[model samples]
Target: MTVDRLGYLGFDASDVDAWSRYANNTLGMMTAAKGKDSDRYRLDSRAWRLAVHRGEADDISYAGFEAADAAAFNSTAERLRQMGYQVTNEPDDLKADRGVIDLVSVIDPSGVRIEVYYGATELFEVPFVSPVGVSSFVTGEQGFGHIVLATPDLEKSMEFYVAGLGMELSDIIDWDLGPGGKHKLHFFNCNRRHHSLALLPAPAPKHIHHFMIESASLDDVGRAIDRMERDSRILLTFGRHTNDHMYSFYGITPSGFAVEFGCGPRDVDRSWSVVRYDSISMWGHKFISPE
Candidate 1:
């Protein structure tokens, strides 16, 4: 499981219109193309870094990780089957949506659909237009930011991501859930972006708590919140997080999902520090309630 980077993510949206508005108007991403069932948003004008598809439920569709080459993609698929998990050649829609030469799909122990692929289709002609008339997102260099998903089996999910996918642990947060004696939330990083994915214990099988995108600066994050609240009447947190050190907040997407608009995420060199686990959140987040 030698994943090169976190390639892209898919969302199952019950309301594509809401996501369209949220992605285009609030997040400052460019909508490169759209169709009746799905729409693609450009984080760095490489076709799309995020795809939202019309569906019956609003949830995370899948997490796609990049393999170094076509051989690596096939090898991963064979390894997954050897481990007693079912793997598939990339679905028709997935292949078309990602514009990849080859891909393999498997469900993790926690039931999250994971896609491993090589050679993503890119667009040179598509120019990124900031929805807020600003500059651009800090992707391409950092790749996209992190996505947090809820899992019932926290420890096993951690093993799958850290050992199976080759992501390194950044830190772990133990939430004081009253009588529960502090449940666990783990963060893992691949590229420089803080925590490409996180695990949260919840009753659900495997669903995203929220997915984040890195903005240019703190001011860009603030402007996004202001516009979302004033014009769209959508409300959420406006505070900085302790873990990532991102001055950010969460708002509901049109798909009835949460999106974290943030900037200034703490990056790592990987070689310098030993993996650290901490108890306290970097800053107090009063907006998002603990469940």
Candidate 2:
């Protein structure tokens, strides 16, 4: 049994103040709680979608992928064990922290921590309203959105996500990054969303490249571009991806990793056929701010 959509992403963040502002003002995500050390951001009705922990690395902590239910979670965990992965069930407190009924943990071949779970606790009793006025986020069964990871061993990482997790190949991109050279981006999807996970294993940095959060309206994306323009941490200018057709821009978060904000990416279904591309974007994702 394969996992569902991308559930949530955690981070080892350095500056809570900067992230608090970036999440609220730039990305327009609602703040659940902000402390001196830890901060929680909410995009939808979920208790929290992104969690920032006090750390020095300023990298990904772990990415949570949801399972359909208890049976599916168990099946996926068992499959991992059978495939020689040392999977372990998380304790009650850890599950409580994640707002999930239960979870199983495993590290992928690329050393990325993964949490597979079911029954996420929703904040339905309390409606979600962004503290900073902005349009809603596109999340539900599709999960908190997609993440792309960079690794030195692409084959192993690809096997882990595909043969191991059973995600479908959405498309492949051979990006000609000019002076930076070339790399292959393999897009995978578990649900209707174009891609919940993408793999890039070359000149690999042991961190998540970026995560995409689809806005409910095109105007919301435009508003965010304005914020990025003033913020100075903007990484890539506004652009549309060729495969997913995601019109978005990338900005470095307080944690030093980029976050993609955009809208109107096409979805997939049973009849979808995978294809490869020469370019990652149709146009405009040029480098905007200093890296």
**Each candidate structure's count of clashing pairs:** 2, 0
Candidate 2 steric clashes: 0
TM-score of each: 0.88, 0.95
lDDT value for model 1: 0.74
For model 1, the superposed segments whose C-alpha errors exceed 4 Å read: 91-93, 177-181, 231-236, 271-280, 288-291
Report how far off residue 62 is in candidate 2 (Å). 0.2
Off by over 4 Å in 2: 33-37, 289-291
lDDT of 1 by residue, 211-237 (tens): 888878777877887877854544346
Model 1 residue 179 CA deviation in Å: 7.9
The per-model lDDT (C-alpha) reads: 0.74, 0.85
